[model samples]
Target: MQRIDSVNVRPDVNGAGKPGFHDNADLSGQDATYLTPTWLNTVQEEICNLIEKNGYTLNVASRQQLYDIIATNDSVTALAEAMENRLVQLQAVLATKSALEQGISYVMSELGQHKTASNPHPQYLLASTFGVHIPMTAAIGRTEIKDENRVLGWNGQSSDWTANTGEITWGGSLSGSVEFTPYRAYGQFLLSGYISTATFFDVNVRVFNAEGIETSLIKVTEYGGSYASYGMNKVFEIPKGGKAVIEYRVDAGYSKRAQMTFSVYVDDRVKVFTPVGLTSVVDATDFTESTQNDVKSDYSSFPAFEWFYGDTNGQYFELSAISNMSDPVNKIPHYHRDKFTQLEKDLYIAVQAGKQTIESPSDYAVIDTQILRARTDAEGNVVVAVPLSMRSITTANNETLVYTFVYYLNEPDVTGALPVGLDGEHKIYVRL
Candidate 1:
């Protein structure tokens, strides 16, 4: 009538023949039931079916292969741990894929809008539009004196003088004097003269200033016996209200007579006006005239800005030297104010700022090409066709947004660990 515990049963014998079940009893025999063993086998089969349904091929029937895969763990623990590890890997892969998708979406949407979120500092755009100046071309006036004259100093006398309208003919025996029409204003004069026979003779031309002092002297000595013609050209600066007299003197030579003819030209053309904030002088006594009388000026002493002869219009002269002149002569205001529209100012500012933003040589090259493609007038003044803020929307906005995305994406996670595959050493497998 007492209940027997199953733990007290022996495996080898039947309960009716023995006080307890025999430990060596065969449960597979016809007299016994293998219910627990059957249930355990059924659970193992179910587990194998579940693994197969979940897209995994497991050789559960081959205990050796299963043991090889899960070498150091029990069968159930090994299988569960492997599945959990694989699931963790899958989650990491999915996270990375989602981040990429979101990043790409953000880039495409920002680019599609063709603009950024409202610029917090709209003043940068406004500053570009206000008070932009561009250079303009203005017609500069110029003049040259082509007037011709022939004046003889005297009819027959060498010392006494009278104006005669003929070439001055003098034997090497007699010297003569001739005068050019006095220049009314400060100007440059080009004098050209020729001597018929300069053989075995001493010929000299002296330029006397308004004060009757010899300012320039030119003398040519003849050494050959053959009669040859000599020509010379000289440039001289005549002061305002100044008169110049050229005295020709020649010693009597073997040649019977020598003919001399001279001509003068005055150039009053203004090549370029002195720029603003500078001083200039015309026919100043401070500089001397060298034989190389081309229209070159050295204004190193009176520096700020200077207009030399033959200067191009609208040329920018970099400041080099400072002026020490306590009182500069002929100082004049010469700079003209340049004006620009709002759009033009924006374009100019964009180009200027873009150039300054270049951080490398490659960037500089790209920016230079872009600037060249920008519109410009014949005078090299920038022209604006559209608002500069709208130009190169993709390049400009992408530069900013992509930079931010990459910077933040590269940052470490909350645990101070990099993404599973981005630790610089791990390999990642992406599904799509």
Candidate 2:
């Protein structure tokens, strides 16, 4: 008796019944047990269960509906993710927009540029070659143009006043146009100049725009006859920017004329605030678990920080950073430093850093509604404080920590004389 392979050599029925009757009986049916037909059936059920667990129903009878919903929901989720990514970008744009609306500039520049980040105005310089230093005391009470007063004139187009007017013509100053630009909102200029009486005669100043329109006389008084050693100083404001002509008219006014000079100092409307470094340490794994309040112990222990202005533009949250890192101005924090105490330095550091963070939520944070009221202390300095709350974050090891933060009022960018219309009628004089 010999053993035969059951897979390829099946029992030969013909060999038993009839001699030499060979037949190749099919063995394909035996291979049918390799895998269960229902193996893939679980895949559909798994997909259906996934949808159902997510508050969706997958009815195989309505395959179209299931696919449609899956695609629709996928598209919606994709859109949501895209929107979240755009949130920060949109906030930056909105902040810039806010600054612009308040006549603020977002572009940074060097000092003395007289240009705001968002606004740049006309830049003026005096030609050094002109010998126009006037003696002191040439300007006195109620002085007008008279003989023997050496005038200091500017044509705006050139540094050579003598060449253009052929010896300082009274009305020969070349007129330049004054155009309105965005930086005009930051500040204005009114200038006045005259010859000193100590080494000179009399001096009077007048301003004219590019349109040949001369503004009203701003400095009409004379400084001569009494104060002979003091040079004249005048500060004024010009509302517009363009070619400005300063007329150096003079008066003999019972004094000798001296060499004259003029200069301008501008006050900018917007400024930059530098950021103090992060006082709190955030765990890389879970941001929500990172407590910020614990890092800053007190105002004295914390690094100084500053904030410029920002716009909301109907947003739920906004993030701002301090870019200026030099010469941080001392400011009264919304919360007093002597008030709180913690055993760990990290705890105080976290609190100070957290206080500066800005956020917008569906509802106001409990810490945002408080106000920073200021009162003059015995030292004549303003002290500000606000109401605040504490929050705790627990780690996986069951250790819990707390952070403190304060609520305060937000100041807008465009702030001025608070009563709105009170300063509207105020006027300052500009000479050139």
What lDDT score belongs to each candidate, Candidate 1 first?
0.32, 0.28
Minimum summed lDDT over a 10-residue window in model 1 is located at 400-409
Candidate 2's TM-score: 0.19
| Candidate 1 per-residue lDDT over residues 1-432, each given as its tens digit | 222224444533435544333433444543323235545667676666455544356864665543444454565686899899989867765778786687678657644443464533232222222212111111112222233221112111111122211221211233455554231223455555556554333444455554444677655333334446676455555444343455553321221234444544433222222122211212212112222211111122222332111123534332211211222222111111112232211111111112112224323212211111121122323311112222233343322110000011122342322233211221111110
Best by lDDT: 1
The TM-score values for the models, in the order shown, are: 0.22, 0.19
lDDT of candidate 1 at residue 428, scale 0 to 100:
11
